[model samples]
Target: MVGYALALALPNGKFDIAHAARTPGDPVRRRPRGNALRKPAGILVVREADMDELGWYPNVETPEAR
Candidate 1:
């Protein structure tokens, strides 16, 4: 394999969750914080299709957290 992986980071932290992957967070983990992963506490549903549009790609640096 080419050793490609989906990199990601915490919503607010100075840690890199993965390598080769570029994103502040993964679209797959766009669920509510309360439910963690078992449930979605909010109505906001982020699909994998929107990953690129939201800056979840390599070469694209993530903006500083506000």
Candidate 2:
């Protein structure tokens, strides 16, 4: 989900997944613009197969993994 958003946000569509994962932005609130909240709009469609190329690892083990 985040990868897709980053892909759209980046002009070249090249971003560091590790950096994004480590220093993530606020998920609940949108970015602020002056005194107004930035409009939350944009649609990105990512195919399941393309996720691997985007560095998405569904099976990667984490501390919470059991």
How does each model score on TM-score? 0.18, 0.16
Candidate 2: tens digits of C-alpha lDDT, residues 1-66: 344333334333232221222223442222221112122343222222333355435767668656
Q: Largest TM-score belongs to which candidate?
A: 1
Off by over 4 Å in 2: 1-35, 38-58
Worst 10 residues of 2 by lDDT: 30-39
Clashes of 2: 0
- Model 1 misplaced regions, further than 4 Å: 1-25, 34-42, 50-66
Candidate 2, RMSD to the unseen true structure: 11.8
Q: Write the per-residue lDDT of candidate 1 for residues 1-66, one digit (tens) a residue.
A: 122222222343222222222323664443333123222232333434445565544655547642
- Model 1's alpha-carbon lDDT is 0.33
C-alpha lDDT values of all predictions: 0.33, 0.31
TM value for model 1: 0.18
Q: Identify the leading candidate in terms of lDDT.
A: 1
